[model samples]
Target chain A: MARKALIENDALIDRLSATFREVGYEGASLALLSEATGLKKASLYHRFPGGKEQMGLEVLQEAGRWLGNHVLKPLAGEGTPRERIAAMTSELDSFYQGGRQACLLNLLSSPIGEESPFKATIRQMFEAFVEALASVIAEAGCTPAVARDRAEHGVALIQGSLVLARGLGTTKPFRKTLDVLADELLADLEARA
Target chain B: MARKALIENDALIDRLSATFREVGYEGASLALLSEATGLKKASLYHRFPGGKEQMGLEVLQEAGRWLGNHVLKPLAGEGTPRERIAAMTSELDSFYQGGRQACLLNLLSSPIGEESPFKATIRQMFEAFVEALASVIAEAGCTPAVARDRAEHGVALIQGSLVLARGLGTTKPFRKTLDVLADELLADLEARA
Candidate 1:
């Protein structure tokens, strides 16, 4: 029974995340969340008695944690900077392609505007991702400042690529952009060497 | 009377464009559009009988054309490549800040999942912007392939910065990102010179 409840909870979060991606925070109403999650309003309320804001916070946190562990943690592990950067970018491309979805950060960040309760969470998530990448860059023996700047550029490129890919309605540009960025960063590192 | 009608039409388009930026294409309903423009539903229908889709298409087209002329066109004009590039970046920053809004291209692109009707228009606008930039790059004496690649990067950066800014709920980062990109390009051009 405990196992079944965990499975149900995972399913609920997944559905909620999808709804948030499809509709902005302000736009995702309780009725729509209920419909998307296949739960009755009572069940949804039971799960998130704190209501939509609670549910949104949970979804954002889950996405941030998942992405950091699966998509980013690998990049921070064993390899030369070039290999790690390549691996990281390839993972990002696959993640986007596999899901046929834009990044959750890109989607959620917009609705969280100035002073929204979710603002700090979203900012922290972004900073965490950047810091993760910077750690990997630093491991490659670059100065801390160079590593941080490169990491910032890499994060920006990934986030930006999604917007461009979505705008062009093709994933080709997105993948290509990431590849170019990876190559450029690797070249810069090699130059330092 | 004709001049007044034209003014009203322009004002309505401006309002619709603002709504689309804030809420996105799918989120902007006719009721919201009417409310945004302070137009009665009857007046909206009179101006846009084809309804929301027609208004969206017109707004998208007009924005594309206006951006091309005011932003990209200047980049393709006579000047040293570095000067032209800086001018272009400044123009883009000003244009975005002028409206205090994210680019319509970035907003509309988000909802264009497979085979969207707006796909062609969006692609065309992007291609035009890149092509204009490419011409300038090539004039700076780079190979056609190199120019095209750099131009693609430039467009990707601009579009991506807009998304980042919108997601972060601050224009400062967006504008800063663009400035960083412009500086990078300028540095590259000077090295080549």
Candidate 2:
């Protein structure tokens, strides 16, 4: 039964994540969430007693898990810096689904009226991303400061490319960004090569 | 009478823009907008017969106007490329209120469900930004393709740094981005020099 529940929760999270990604945190109304998930309000409430906040938090946690497994893990994996980053690049392209998906980090980071309850979670995710990238950059023989700066700049390029991709209504910028990313991150390494 | 109406309209747009920037399109409720603007719903409806969509559009249009006057125009102004970019950089810092303010272009670009009515306006704003910046890069003696690429990369850095700043709850990244911007934009020129 516990196993059954785990599977069920995963399914629920998938549905909820889809809704949030489409409309953003504020856009995901209870009515819309219910319609999308095919779960009555009560059922959703029974599962997520804290209502939309809980749902959003759970969805965010799931994204964090994915990031940990797919993004952070690979960056820390056994491959060289180039191999790891290239792997990360592929995962990012898939994770964002070729720039067709909106980033939950951007969408749910800020909500109207009050501070977002997810700020810490969002911060942790981005921090982890930077740290992971910085590690690889450090491994590539850049100074710690250079590693940190490059990591931050890399994340900025990614987040900014998503915004640019969506604003321009094309994926060309995103693809172009990905193409240059590995080289950009390894510039210090290649400078000595 | 016309003058009075124009003044009132600008005031209304300011209030509405503030509200939208905070909550986003989906988060901005009639009640919240009414409360923020200190106007009754009926009065708001009276001013914006097309309702929330119209209000959002007007706010976006006002932002576009500000960009043209403050950002694009300065970039195209007579000066060395570095001087013009430096001037434009100051405007950007002020416009975004030293990274404390969220960008309307990022905020209003994507709406939940049924496409943003403001996409065209948002696109034009970014396009103008790129075009203006690209022109400066070209003037700095880079090829047109290189100019366009750098302009896009520069924008991605700006947009991404804003996201980074907000996520990290510090304006350091944003400020750092500004510091490096002039050099990055004119790297080609500096290389030849």
Best prediction by DockQ: 2
Comparing only chain A of model 2 with the true chain A, what is the TM-score?
0.92
TM-score of chain B of 2: 0.91
Residues A89-115, candidate 2, lDDT per residue (tens digit)?
Answer: 999998887777778888887732247
Note the residue pairs that clash in candidate 1.
none
DockQ score of the complex predicted as candidate 2? 0.53
For model 2, what fraction of the real interface contacts is kept?
0.49
- C-alpha lDDT of residue B140 in model 1: 67
Give the TM-score comparing model 1 with the true structure, all chains together.
0.83
Chain A TM-score of each candidate structure, as shown: 0.85, 0.92
**Candidate 2, residue A112: how far the Cα is off, in Å:** 11
Across all candidates, what is each one's fraction of true contacts kept? 0.42, 0.49
lDDT of 1 at A156: 69
What's the residue-level lDDT of A126 in candidate 2? 89
